[model samples]
Target: MSPIELNKRQDTILQIVKENGPITGEQIAERLNLTRATLRPDLAILTMAGFLDARPRVGYFYSGKKTMTTASESMMNLKVGDFQSLPVVVAENMTVYDAIVQLFLEDVGTLFVVDEKSHLQGVLSRKDLLRTSIGTQELTKIPVHIIMSRMPNIVYCKKSDSLIGAAKKLIDRQVDSLPVVNETENGLEIVGRLTKTSVTKAFISLAETHDL
Candidate 1:
């Protein structure tokens, strides 16, 4: 069945399974305020779609095999512009302490370091801040640019890249997030970011509907 044809209830069931795997039909019904009888059709359809699995006594669980395959397929189906978060950037001249404050305020793990023109310059992570903090040097005197991962070596995603592709990069590179860049006359400009947490959450959402 087309993804569009899946009703909201079915979608919710799949998501729940994805999030709380090895869940039971009764548990799903309780969460949705529906009866097991009413939810059977959805469970059946999701199982048929390779999105769910049924254990003898445990109830239902999401089939990881299906989740991975479906997530990959979904990623391939995305337009580059769809999965980006608006750029949250720090100026290169900003102090490490300033960047730390930004990181805390934004509740993000990384920050894009940008030049005066907003061109991609570097990337700063929480680790960098913590490591620097251990030294006797004053944070206020340390420039963020000095500690950031320099350009060219940075792994970035385009606004048009699929979420799966971005997630793969994050996993393979062992990075927390990727900056989304826009091609500019001078060079790539920082446009946004895609975090591993966000990608994982998306996958969990996708699995919530299945009974398994």
Candidate 2:
């Protein structure tokens, strides 16, 4: 027969065991306001599923092997809204030279381009500025809109997307940053950004959780 899946209560029991492991069944029942008679079935099933181990006198302990996959699953389910970084925006009319200064000052690889109305126009990366500065010093006179990437072709994401989805865009496109946008009455508004660094920080957090 196939193994039984853990129900919500069982999941909780497993968590309690992990946190307060080597704890007795009586203590687990007391913490949840449940009687040993009522909690025995769940405790038995978790132990049977290899999620918990019970000693003759030492109560319950968590099996250390299974939490790796659980932590990975939790990382994949994280939403973009909570992790996005503040946008570094420049007006479309700004000069490329000025935009270059802002780019360096902000120390970001990509900058979000916006019109006076605060609507997204395009994106600018260090490459864009470097290409503009190669032979032409007219960067001071040229408007950013002249060299900036335009919209519709921009690969972007909404605030509600998963971090894994945003990570894919960064990887597949070989780009360093993506503008997090939201559709509005006039046009798409730049809300936040997802960067390669953001993904790194997330991975670090997952690693820390796994170590715990």
Candidate 3:
């Protein structure tokens, strides 16, 4: 399961409650310099999501429950394969110049490389190609496999992996994309691609599902 994500204001309210427990609604509002009417929605949401509790004649206190229904809850439950797009790939033996052309023609920042048997071999990014094409370097002579990130060094995802896990990996590794692959006895077989666009699409779909 993924963490229950909160908006900026919600986070602030949570911090305030943690630091000053049993805080009254009016006091909480004063700390944030917001009117009680404006902060009501957040308070109600926090209470409903089990993040806060209210007592008669008292104030609001932290519930100590971590789970909540977030705007991205639908997205977090989705599988990586559900949002993966058709992968763009090039032969490992393809020239760097040709790889550049494909990268542009396909309008993608990264490309997966494959062996003659169509097994996953490596990954090539725009930066990788650009780095090799600089100065007097001969891009036409250099094979993609020479500069591509080889297997075992590549970060990938399985179809069954959760979407939130994928997002975390993307942020943690600082990579633009991840290959959706299948593990075979021989090696991983690239099936699809998961990029920032994929995550955006998932979010849009989730929002639509909620009629929001």
Candidate 4:
């Protein structure tokens, strides 16, 4: 799973909790000279992400679960094939309006643009559609290929890739997902999609296995 990037204050909050926990929210807030209300969101996020645990009256405490180094090593062992979802694809010539409809119907954040042979040609994202929609151009008149991000610009992965490596690409590229492809004589064939949700599921699976 992608690590949650904590802000300075959030990092400070975690340190305080680590050193003096089962500490109360109020006490934590006091140390930082902030209101309890102000610290509530950060505490909630840390707790939900499994960094901390809370008791009704006992307040908050670090979970002291597996260290980051150990968890990262386990995550590196995960393969993209194990966690990817089926690719949601659209024909390159498909109208932007139709692509938008297909996107919502499929409940996907991205649509892979493909040729007649199902070879990847480009990628269409929610941001792309939104940008098109707000323009004066008629959506139906425009083809997805016009606005889609085409290769050699696409970031992709193979089924054999490590999940951690693919996850890093997703982060560095700042894209919602990557097409999991298979190389063929013709081109790259879209076999699956590696997404943040997939990474999160992998992390949850890893956590469960550790507990077991």
Candidate 5:
């Protein structure tokens, strides 16, 4: 998604193509005093970078695309549903002690609290459990709902939401993850989870896919 910096020969090739458009690779090589075989790699790079368009018989022409697709553009196109992980959920009535155990068992930083219908109720984070554990009250006696971040305060994203938007929510809300939810007549239904790790993996995938 980053800009492709052209080398000296590449820059000259681009300029040549721009001035004398629809030029064949052999012709361009002749002007540069180089063999077509020598320029093959550069032509491939330019075409793949969106700087040039190739045709069957017409040959290569300037595409007018100054650079590869911008990072912001690519990120905005990444949907949360594509990279979201399975939701780790717990009942709101579950004891904090059990929640902590579940957290460890699942190896997740956050848990979604739901009701009998599996509708979202609140969110329990490791920090919340840790803070409560240090208190005098027994962890077994306290329900997760007592400390979980309640709805209307919980920041979440839809499956169709952009990964970049979800990432921004994570940063602005200062949370490690966001619930990927679906809207129903009752309430929000947890479909998945978008975490910082998910975003990182998505970025890595994008880079590798684009050969950036």
Candidate 6:
């Protein structure tokens, strides 16, 4: 079935799953102001499109594994420019101590190291700082660039890419976060970061719908 054929209601059902999956048909109906019987066809189409899953006891759920495929297809149907996030970044010249402090204060596991021009230079993790600090290195004088994982090795995702794609990369690399880059006219620039924690939260949010 062509995605273009999906009606507004079907799209809405898919979105509801994307944002809140592992939900029951009754729950979805309530959110859309419809009865369960009215939503059956919509749910059927979404499940056929690989956007949703229905289980005996669970009722219905957004396919976490299939979210990437559905998201990529849905991008063509939705406004591409609608979703964007401004990335938080740090300078390459920042001290290790400062990076550590910032990581704690911001409650983030990774930090992006950027040049003065706001170009992505590298990435630093808590492990990197701790490893360096164990050697009796002076944290205040050391630049983050000296220890950061340099480019060509940096695993990143474009903002245009779906969250599922980014999450897959993070899982495959066994990393905690991914830098979101913008493919500008000049080069790739860091715009945001997506972390495992955020992905977990999204999943939890989706699952919570069933509890209610």
**Using Cα atoms with residue i matched to residue i, what is each candidate's TM-score against the true structure?**
0.64, 0.67, 0.64, 0.66, 0.67, 0.59
85-179 in candidate 1: lDDT tens per residue? 55689999999988999998988899998888888889888888899989747999989888899866789898667677888889998888899
Q: Global lDDT of each model?
A: 0.75, 0.78, 0.80, 0.83, 0.84, 0.70
RMSD of candidate 5 to true structure, Å: 12.7
Winner of 4 and 5 under TM-score: 5
Q: Write candidate 4's Cα lDDT for 128-172 as tens digits.
A: 999999984799889999999998899999998988899999999
Give candidate 2's TM-score: 0.67
How far residue 19's Cα lies from its native spot in candidate 5, in Å, is: 38
| Per-residue lDDT value at 54 in model 6 | 79
How well is each residue in 1-212 modelled by candidate 3, as lDDT tens digits?
A: 23455667877998899889899989999999997756765675566456788786788888886656655554555677667777999998899999999999999989999998888899998788888888437888888998999867788998789877998888887888899999999888999888888888666545443342
Model 6 stretches with alpha carbons more than 4 Å out? 1-86, 209-212
Cα RMSD to the true fold for all candidates: 11.6, 12.7, 14.6, 13.2, 12.7, 11.4
Output the better candidate (1/5) by TM-score: 5
Clashing residue pairs, backbone N/CA/C < 3 A, model 6: 87-191, 87-192
Estimate the overall C-alpha local distance difference test score of candidate 1: 0.75
- Determine which window of 10 residues in candidate 5 has minimal summed lDDT: 203-212
Model 2: per-residue Cα lDDT over 171-193, one tens digit each: 89878889999988899899998
Q: lDDT tens string, model 6, 1-212? A: 33234556766887887788778999999999997756654564465456677797777777743443443343233211112233557898998889989888887788888888888889898889899889656999998899999879899887556556677888998888888788778667886667777567444433332122
Q: What is the Cα-based lDDT of residue 62 in candidate 1? A: 78
lDDT of 6 at 167: 72
Candidate 5, residue 23: how far the Cα is off, in Å: 37
Higher lDDT: candidate 4 or 6? 4
Q: For model 5, state the Cα shift of residue 158 in Å.
A: 0.4
| The candidate that achieves the highest lDDT relative to the unseen native structure | 5
Sorted by lDDT (best first), the order is 5, 4, 3, 2, 1, 6
Q: State, as a TM-score between 0 and 1, how close model 6 is to the true structure.
A: 0.59
**Positional deviation of residue 111's Cα in model 1 after best superposition, in angstroms:** 0.5
